[model samples]
Target: MDLTRFFADVDAQPWADLHHAYGSAADIPGHLRALAGESEEAASEAISELYGSILHQGSVYGATAHAVPYLARLAAAGHRTEDLLVLLGGIAEGGADEGDSDEAACRTAVAGQLPLILARIDAEDPGLRRAAAWAAAMTGAAGQVLPALRMRGKTETDPRVRAELLGAMAHLDPPGTAAEATGAIGAHEPGEVRIVALLACVDGGLPWGAAHHAAMLSLLPANDLVQDRLDLERNEPLQYVVEELLRRDTDADRAAAYTLLDAALRSAVPEARAEAVWAAETACLLSRSAPERLAGAVEALAADPADVSSAYSLLAKLGGRAAAAVPVLARLAGGEGDPADRALEALVAVAPDRAAPLLARDLERRPRALAAACGSLGGGTSGTPFPYDAVLLDAIRARLRGGGPGGNETIRLALLLGAWGSRASAALPELRSALPGAPRAVPKALVAICPPEHRETTAEFLTAAARTGPADGRLPAAAAVRELTGDTGPLLAAVADRLTPGGPAVQEAARLAAELGPEAVGLVPALRSALSGSVGERTSPQLDADAEIAAALWRITGDPEEAVPVLAGVLAEAEPTWMRWTLGRAARAAALIGEAARPLVPALEGLLDGRVQVPPVVLALHAIAPEHLDGPRAAALLLEAAERDDDAATALEALVALGPPALTPDHRRRLTDLAERDLRVRASGLEPGIAPADERLREQAREAARGLT
Candidate 1:
């Protein structure tokens, strides 16, 4: 508790080299120093930033551990007990979106500080007691913390504090605590108090599958990512909240949880429904089957004016299981708004049969709806195909022939026709004629709609648009000319003549040329010249120039040899503030080189020092050299990285590549659990936005672990 001694003890660690959310923990010393300085505003700001960085969202980083002992000292010396306790609780929880190993690392970090934290659980301040109680639960210091929690629960007069203590006690799962948990969460308790008690009860093996399951039915979701109306600034994402619950729910409460979620979905308030959506999404992940239990609620909400858009999204997430919503979705599709197309997509997802007629009728009634309708038709040609291709194409052609179609509408029609590829070939001449009016979009449309021969002259039209056609249209024009023409020579000439030295379309021209890849191998020198200035000195807008130039060099040369040294040197030091843009492109180029990038490994490892953009840096490592983890320092990071859900499979593959000796029992268990979840996620058809590559990575991780198990 001696502040001076604590500061010296903490300061001795090489804090600068540690990693926080954005970058190095080097800046952390300055913040901690400010906390002990005179400025209250600076101290408060330091605290706020700390929450975002070390304990970002709800995930803990290695720097998080390094900071805790110092923070514990600060709290003990009475600098800021209440807020510090709250932050300690969150850090102790680590990142709920990850596996147990990651959380265990967090607990391990705080384990030595338990006596200091536990002593505060029964403090005089109710808020301090409440926060410390939560922290104790999170740290799993049941032996030291539980007795204090039980003592505080029985005698604490303040309802909120007592409820928090009860919750912590329940989470520890001692004798007679179930009855205490139920009592604490009763109607007499406030919603906030009930939420704490219920989560603990659920965590303590209490089944939420009971018909009148109080825990699931009550407790307004406070997670910032899911609910509104609450403090949006501080909540962990819904994914984290759900993972925390599912990971702890040994009670198999999926069915009853679904029933509660159904009720939450129908709640009149939007925020409540959002929370329900979070729970529903979690249900799909945990159940290994489609969440049809919430179908009726989703169907009912699909028509609710306040809920329509989100409801359609939920149904779309349900995929083929929510077939019951088709009629409602079909009705909703005819109505205009953002939700309408989403509704149509949901309808297609379940019942493409009914969706076809609905789209056809809507197109007939609303010619302006042509783009949205045609855009919906094939859904990139991979979704439900254009069943009524004849009807939809006829409507698109008819709308374009009209004397009054607006420029934007014209562009939409042309683009939709282009997306059809060969299917819209017959309309090429007409599309070509319309190019004079809406030249910018028509050419890109022609790129896809017209045969290469018919579209060759369309580049001239796009070039003219690139010179004028309002402000925003030029980039699209240059992009289109580059794509539609499939000819890089003229653009590279323009890149030299007009695009460089700050022409209106300079960036776009360079970007378009980069797409030319090895075909524009001649432009390598020009591209390399653009990357000369110090990357750290570059601003955000200027960073794009560096990335494009780097990408162009890598793509055109089929090697990163030229750009690698410059990019690696730029990223070699503590990254500049605007470094994410450059870092991503650099890592990408390094990834292209793969194992050949051995020389660049040390530089990428510096970025993975648990700082900002750790994922990409880790990915870069995975791409360049999974074998790098065989070294001691990188190997330790790999074990922790494997515990993260996002980083898990990739990290597992890396560890497995190191062979059976590196594969521990804990690692194998987490791997098996994640593999099972990936299968469930794929079967449900709701990636929610995860790439298909994630599933492939999951499979690869399993194959890598095939023999070790």
Candidate 2:
């Protein structure tokens, strides 16, 4: 039984050997034990061979399984246990990484051998016990090893051994529980022990460890290690525990507690607050109501205005249950309060109708509050118009006339114009006067308000602005043009002209022309000409303009002949794969424009033939003419493609489109035979290489045959 020779033979054999070798565990360990008793050098060589083979190749066999049992027997035969443990540890660690069932079985065997080894540790010298603990830790079964270490910690005579046990406990709870466990070790143990205990308590939610929370907090001031632990906990969802400590603990402890709590709330998600709310509700139910918990949160909001946003978000989730906090909200929203502006904004968001009248009156007194109030009224729960619209409009107009330093007046004017809708026709003179200097956002609001007859006037203003305003103004001006013209040809042409030197403005104008419906038909030639001229520009400043114009042309003419070629060219030339796919789709979209695109059939067929795998091409051909295979040449080409390995699927698809009338009886029979052959091969559990693709091709041929029938 030369182990090296045996392993070499197994390695030479193929994977099929596994099926014939050791069928059960009983046959494995016995064989290895016999081998181990032969000779020390031979046994070690055998074990080493087995370990290397299993660890590297990950193959399982009766001989490989015997490797561990032989090592254990050698150790019992007065061989060095230290050497055996090192060999076993390496095998166990390697097996864990393999993650195969056989590797897992090997790990189980190693774990079974641990108790026997630990027994050796107890009876042997103190140094051996230390070595045994290290071996046991390597097994990674923390639950089993932790109890043993804890027992050893009680009377292990050597301080160094006890220290190693504490370190083992810390490693066991990697997620911060190590601190709590370490704290619990001796007094009682070392500071490291206490810290591990605190970590364990935080991690495991151990109520018994609550006593250490105060100590851990105190250590935070002087120790960076403790401060790190606090910071780690601050990021955890359970930081609420620290916040609760601040609230329920001594008043003297409140300041430091508040600092930790504030940091946690700032970093936490909405669910964190929900957890806090639930905790607060639970505490209030358990004891008498503690206003301090809610008060602490409210006070934090008052100290920092941004904190009020979460308070409102939390209250919204609490629904009417948070009605108790309404007075706090009201006081915060009141003038002279610290976070009053944000408070009022949040209150309207949470309960807009109830807060609307109060907000309206506040708008008159405080013009800065007017913008926030208007935004609130627009999006708030009321749905009805603002209560004091007349007063608000007067304030807005005054702000506009006064020409305030900031853009606040412009914002106020936009809100007022949006509020007016068609009813603001009386303000036409004022609106007209304000158009030139108004913020870009104002024109869109004016478009929403302007009357039908005045739409022309609005378009004139927008077109003028599009010509004169900054680059940013062009988009809103284009939108205004769309709103005014409502698919008129002149407006469509104007948008196209403005879009020629194409930027965002051109892109927006193209979109506007597309929205104009049939009236945009006039821009097709312009869009096509631009697309043609810019085809080779390498960087068509107007490529997006061309795409948008194509879309507008499709919308206006419903003619595929004019749009498909342009779209195909773009698809072929586009750099980004996604944009190429988009243009390919647009080219195929000609099929969707009704029978008018019948002329695109040759182009689509060419695209499909060119290996341009665009879905729209198939859809276009099907839509325009399903019975398109009218000639002998086309039918032969399809048949020839169907015969080729790579083009088989495409040919089958073409046949399916041509329908049954296009296929002869011989062709039909051939395709059905191919399909049946594939089905039989698959049924027998053999690999079906190109057979599935061939089957799809056959299906298409059958469809073509059926159409001929």
Candidate 3:
């Protein structure tokens, strides 16, 4: 496969001036030569370099347009044909700047080589045929490519190749995809081919009828057969079906999804049943009724001893909503080993009160269950802490007395005892005995659990830790000393030292300095130094540190000179696409400055339309420029953010700041609905930790509604 014609004018082009992800494109010619060389090893390395430099992370560059023609020619000559076709397809998908001539040129260059791409769709190699199908559709020359794909779909012999052809047809002609897919989903086609056809129907927005649903259920656990040969959206067909149905959010669509999943869960095959259970978890994350509808079915699976681990994980994610599974979980918790511990964890998340006695009974054997109880019940703002059972407290005391708890277990024990506050005074001697081994974790617990008579001793111990302990323990110790003795002397000096530029704890130090107010007047120079020391383009953390320092300086010195400009810059700058939390921090600092932030009103107003930005922007405007705010606009945005759970607590706080007059009758009704709904406002994705935060948001919404009335 000689490439003399392909490289005829490659060197005549000025590759140095053109740019890729790696700056100069001067090395692109060598990579291109090596990619077509005889050695397979060199070709592999060269292609990887080309992907890194020219099409880096899916973003095409100026040099990518120039290289597309050569790539297409190499692929046609049957040299790494499949790999080159895949690369050409990716470049043709337009990762460059929208409407840029370079992006247009890249697409045009690929389209010009459609003859080569179309020829490979009939190649003897199934892999080459699949790649050719994908590349042909990506060129966007539908007038020419669609007829060829429709022709190939009729005669493709391999099931995998047929599935690829169906996907390509769906991409080119969505309205026509349903008709083409219907023929492919017949009894004659293979299981994987029918599954792809079903997906194509969904992708085309065709009405899903009874036939389609029946066909999908017959192909249970198609995950094994529907290999990701073409890099389709999801690897599991059942999961893809459930997600698409629930995303439509219509009652009829959801009903159809529930029927299919319910049948799959009852299958006797272990793998099929497990896959169905996994798909049900996806449905639960998407739909509010999924936990209630599927909980009993999942609980039935828990009856089997071997299936308990997977069932428990999903049940724990369901949280209190899976109350029906508590009986089954309770039975499993009585046994021994990892399954029992897992059952206890699920029980703790579902019903902490009932799980407490069980935790007390097996405290020595179930470390994970104990940790789950501490994590789920110990830290939230709205829920009750883990109840203090006499048996549980005694077990903890035994562990401390015998010196059995390790570092992490010791911390958990301290936190559990601290939650009981003065009620746990009976265990004070044991806590003190365990203190020397875990000084950093124990002092905070000691200050919380100790009575007034013992506070002086605790304070003395903290003072010693503050002055001479490890770097990680010093500031926390000083903070505890201030909490116990009301002495700022230790904390003030600690804050000044931690506020040094490039320090590890500058954010926390600056926040503590703000709490000291005028007492921190001596630390203004340090605050100012940290504020201006950001290098290059400010990153998210750098922006956050600046916000904290600015707030500290304003509180200490009451001067807007240093504080206002940084806040203004944060407000005026483009929000980082990655971190949505940075602007909220800056908005909070501006709110603290109050009237000094008057100059930032326009910048904050410009940020009103963003969902994540609304809560903080509303609060900032309320503090600095309330008269200029459009109450209805702020209220609508706040309600939208609250509904989507984009920082629901902050949105409710903004609602409170907007006051009752901002909320119309409709707004109040919606707010009441949010307060009283059984489903959590923030339930998205698979994070089980959001349960407590959702409870907190619900309580805030209830408080906001009542206060408004």
- Top candidate (TM-score): 3
List model 1 lDDT by residue over 523-575, tens digit each. 76666655546545655445555555665666778676765665565456335
A best-first ranking of the candidates according to their TM-score comes to 3, 1, 2
| Candidate 2 Cα deviation (angstroms), residue 240 | 11
**What TM-score quantifies how close candidate 2 is to the native fold?**
0.43
lDDT of 3 by residue, 100-158 (tens): 67677778778888999999988999989999988888777889998998798778889
How well does candidate 1 score on lDDT at residue 160? Answer: 64
Off by over 4 Å in 2: 1-236, 239-324, 336-338, 354-390, 405-416, 419-430, 437-439, 451-490, 532-543, 569-709
Clash pairs for candidate 1: 21-612, 22-612, 224-235
**Error at 627, model 1, angstroms:** 8.1
* Rank by lDDT (best first): 3, 1, 2
Question: Candidate 1 or 2, higher lDDT?
Answer: 1
TM-score of 1: 0.60
